[model samples]
Target chain A: MSTAVAHRPGLHSWLTLIRCEAKMVVRDTAGLVVPIGLPLLILVMNASAAGDEEITAGRTALDLYILPLVFTIVTATIGIINMPSFLAYYRRSGILRRLAVTPASPAMVLIAQVVVSLIQAILGIALAFAVAVLAFGAHLPVDLGPAVGIVALSIAAMYALGMVVAALAPTPNSAVAIGLVGFFGLGALGGLFGGRDSLPGPLATLGEWLPFGASVEALSNAWAGQPVEAVHLLSLAVSAVLGAGIAAMFFRWD
Target chain B: MSEPAILAEGLHKQYGDTVAVDDISLRVERGETLGILGMNGAGKTTTVELIAGLRAPDRGSVRVLGLDPRRDRGAVRQVLGVQLQHAYLHGALTVVELLELYRSFYPDPRSTEELLELVELTGQRKTRFEKLSGGQQQRLSIALALAGRPQAVILDELTTGLDPRARRRMWAAVESLREETVILVSHAMEEVERLCDRVALIDAGRILASGTPAELVAQSGAPNLDEAFVALTGKELEIEEESA
Candidate 1:
């Protein structure tokens, strides 16, 4: 019998793995719809009133507040809730353990899942932007570069938080439960229900430093053509680093 | 090519205070079929898992085709195919899709059609893993283990949920792999009698005896391996719980 050795998987193999990951995301109706749908719904309800009022520069309240909130929702929903649940499912079901025995490392699955989740986030952001622009006549951020930068930072921060959820959660259901609690807790403080101004002084101060609040505050500045606060950017960057560190320390393959 | 297909010596594994495998040694030469017979939780699974490099041995070494399984993981994985007890695959993936994914992980892998036919899963190629029956899932698991066309294979509880006809078909598949090394973990005496060139009886994480199925029966003064197994491993019933 031939004893030819198997080589590490190449780019084509990665594409195939990614394609399968995408299929799983698409097939889960609830996972597919909620992240985009819930945010779009919020945007539609708030866009009409917010779009009429200008906050600063050529941007309206819709651009400075509503749009940033909607975009953050897109990233947080996919990163915190959807992604972690899938990972926890794989771990609980032993898919990661099984892959560890094969030539393909389990890290391949994590990367593929991240790729798929990123695409989903992009799709959600695009849909919300389209509806806000065409239906409500909303305009793009005046400081487009900074706005883009903040959105990217927001995505990284939320996914880092999701990794923590995936690492600690023992089961798929528990992952979702934990993710939801995290989302709502952060959302409640970060102006998901209303502006942080309505919150108590110390809580409002804390909200501005958290990922969701910091993300919104930075993007709002970018929309108004103002310099993004150094503290907010620092907050997001720190959250990303700490979240990844915690996950790496606690995560198990099996 | 002349090296033993698998060699394990003084294997010891523990979980907290419980010993899963205790000072066990096993060797299988090239093209040999060794059946590891044990009652549930008798370290049969743990033994094969150690050999497969899925779990680390606290006080032993495992070599596959003369290469350390842990140290030479990449090379060892290329030549060793393992079918573990649990069917741990993505539930959303279809049979063909899962096969394709595994196929990508190897330089030379069996074709989807060939593997499906081998495991009698051709008709369910498009069916998702969660939708398959228990027996079908077991067959697919076996098919996956063979996907890489490995030189050595480890099969744990190969036909646990299979029907008689399916069991015979699986046995035939194993029979056809005569030139390859195989380590089969089983509780079925008939399976061991029919397929293994040699056998090892294990109890309490240690090997009680090992030889040809007929030799084991002869040594125990029992008519068949079933009665011989009881005679060799002690007839008293012991309820043992798995530590892992």
Candidate 2:
């Protein structure tokens, strides 16, 4: 009956939220398979398909294209699909309602979900990297630190975009369906699948500014140990902010 | 104690053209348990939702412990607990896991084990929310409501569809709690008669009578709460007329 000044033990509180979300994510294996297995399959195909014929950009290799698709896959999986589904699930289950009445901040809930999705993206990258190395003879990235940065940026943007999609969708299923379309559509447009050279100049230019494309460019630059362009970072930052804002406006707990 | 734990004035809610909760006002004081009796579509749920801050009333205001439920939701929420009928938790999560998770929300949550023991679900702590029987789920729900140790608890038709023994168990469980205030929305007049200190008999979204059990029975010249309710509302003879 009394509202005491609610306090938690610092990072442990945030970390506990993250850990709980991660446990739920891992326990729901059906959700995990989509993000992980698909990326591995694509990595193998690209490594096998690597050739002059597969190179659309004059100096680009097939695996280079896979970098952006990695993010596209991650974005679709977490940002678009998982965001709405989980939000709806929480709202319906009264988990959000209970949490709404609690001392825990909504920002923390946002962070926990993003962390869970980021962990999944990490697993995807690890899986792809393993496939590239063992199955397709991919030489690993020279720069570990930069690669890590790229992964982090790519995941952050994807997570944010996912939040936007989840907020906009009418229902959880609708969010997932629409999210997948945009998820894969942008990836394909960003020259993930192939045939970028045949596209109109305006369309190709527009594609470069799209979410995963910009992220892929930054990540690939990072993997090559080259300094990342500030534009890429800015684009990602914008997507994230916009996404978080949308989630704040529309995210319902009860 | 001068101010009631709950108070509402001119509460009106509309979903487009449908007036769900039509201009209702009621109040409950500290240590008072108010039972609301209404049939389906009588605006019971809407009224409860309005008071609970689950929905924003289109007109008028609601205050729980002197704080507006809508405007001061977080502050008021910390002070009030609600257990809605047929409300459920995550199916995959065990009762213990659920209790632990819910505990994280409250600044000073009750001991999970003690709550389970109090609800008589101590042995079923490992059971998932879906795994428990209907009665067990109801008990766990009461346990969850008690989690925050709130000043007021609102139970929306807590005993509907429950068997006799289960209903009795729930009543006993509720009685043992030393709640400052409890508002029960139920159709069962006997359930209200058994547990409530006071009740508001509502029909068509308006309070028909408000008093102690014996007072209502005596005022209506009825043998019991049911007959009293039927007499006060004047709906029983209408049913009889329809049946005839």
Second chain TM-score for model 1: 0.93
CAPRI verdict (incorrect, acceptable, medium, high) for model 1:
medium
Which residue segments of model 2 deviate by more than 4 Å? A1-16, A48-63, A105-107, A134-137, A140-147, A198-202, A225-235, B236-244
lDDT of 2 by residue, B1-244 (tens): 4888889899888887878777788889887888887666678878988998878888888888887777776677677888876566656667887777666666777899889878888888888777889788888888878787778888887877678888888898788766568899887778889999888877777777888999999999999887888899887522111110
lDDT, candidates in the order shown: 0.88, 0.72
Task: Candidate 2: give its CA RMSD in angstroms.
Answer: 4.3
Binned by DockQ into CAPRI classes (incorrect, acceptable, medium, high), candidate 2 is acceptable
lDDT of 2 by residue, A138-171 (tens): 5544465766666676676777777777677777
lDDT of 1 by residue, A43-71 (tens): 99999999888767778889989999999
lDDT of 1 at A248: 94
Relative to the unseen true structure, what is the C-alpha lDDT of residue A43 in candidate 2, on a scale of 0 to 100?
63
Q: DockQ of each model against the real complex? A: 0.55, 0.31
Q: Give one clash count per candidate, in the order shown.
A: 0, 2
Cα lDDT for residue A167, model 1?
Answer: 90
